[model samples]
Target: MGTAAVSIEHLGYRYPRQSNIFTDLNLQIEAGERFGIFGPNGAGKTTLMHCMTGLLSFQQGKLSLFGNDIATNKKETNKLFGFVPQDFSFYQELSPVQNLEFFGAWCGLNKQAIKQRTTELLEILGLADVRNKQVQKFSGGMKRRVNLAIGVIHDPRILFLDEPTVGVDIQTRNAIINYLKELNKSGTTLIYTSHQLSEAEELCNKIALIEAGEIIAHNTLDNLLSEHKEDGLEGLYLNLTGKAYRDGNV
Candidate 1:
């Protein structure tokens, strides 16, 4: 059998002086799957992604990437995935080319490789005209594209995206979604979290619904809808997690 793309076993996490955010969470995502993690605001969806990407440390259990222990082989595992956080993760003052150069270097790409990759991403993401322009002057959609380009510079096997297309026009959103679909088609395992249920339905083959830091539902989108007798992700989400205010900022 092939190794799972992401494996979480009895995963637990909490911050100091705070109650447990989540405990005993277990999930397995297979390679080449477009997987979505959906939940209400403050439901620990971002926190779970952070843990998986090694941005935040967990207090218990195991996280593995393709069968390698992340805790034990942090360096090795780090090279296997890329994380595109919800926030702008690049230097706004820098040009897209500059940001890619810096990030590509950080990922161990040499001068020639960085130059080639930077050009490819600029053209592919529609940033070729503004390749040398500072990112701060670009529109929200352009900035989002830059952020995504930086994340995948090294072409990691797994990509962890947190709200990769937040606050953009429908056209830009569609462009990003199409690019992501092509990436997934090329065999990159995607672990994504977003409030866009309709977008999630369009992108993800499997879905996991979380509330209060726990996974309440996990299955293929079709199976989840069928088993719960719901028509779509929204119905399944509300049916499983309720309509109460979350009151969480995690």
Candidate 2:
């Protein structure tokens, strides 16, 4: 079998002056699969992404990206994935073209290649007309598109998205989803987390539902649906986590 796109084993983590954030977490995301992680606000989904991408450290267990251990091969592993964080990670002052050029250079793409990709992404993401305008001045949806464009500048094999379509117009959301579908269709693996269960249902073939830092369930969407006898992800989540509202930092 091919090496998994991402693999985590017996993972454990804790925050300063707090109890364990998660313990005994384990998952494997195969290549070409759209994998989703769903949970309440503080379920540690984003934290897990940080650990997988080397943004944060954990106390125990192991994570690997395409067979490269993140703990021991950080740089090599980083080259295998792209991450779109929940918050905007790019400079607000920079124009879309400039931001893409800078990030493309950081990804080691030559000048011509950067220009080509910048133009293509701008057009494909519907930002061509505003490519020269400062991102801070753009609408929420436009900024979201810019964020997505930056994450995909290098076209990495795997993409990690954290609530990527949040707070956007339906048009922009659809555009983003369509682009992501095209990417996954072309064999780019996806690791997605969001409160948008309906969207997740449409996007992910496999999922791991987490609560209180524990994986309550994990499997293919079809299998999970059958096992839980739930018609939708939202129903399954409610069945598993109850109806209480959760509060935590995004």
Tell me each candidate's TM-score.
0.97, 0.97
lDDT winner among the candidates? 1
Q: Each model's C-alpha lDDT? A: 0.92, 0.92
State candidate 2's TM-score.
0.97
Please give the range of 10 consecutive residues that has the lowest summed lDDT in model 2.
241-250
> Model 2: clashing residue pairs?
none
Candidate 2 displacement at residue 240 in angstroms = 1.1
lDDT by residue for model 2 over 146-197, one digit each (tens)? Answer: 9999999989899999999999988998999999999999889999999999
Tens digits of per-residue lDDT, candidate 1, 24-52, equal 99999999999999988888898899889
Pairs with steric clashes in candidate 1 = none
Best prediction by TM-score: 1
After the best TM-score superposition of candidate 1, give how far the Cα of residue 194 lies from its true spot, in angstroms.
0.3
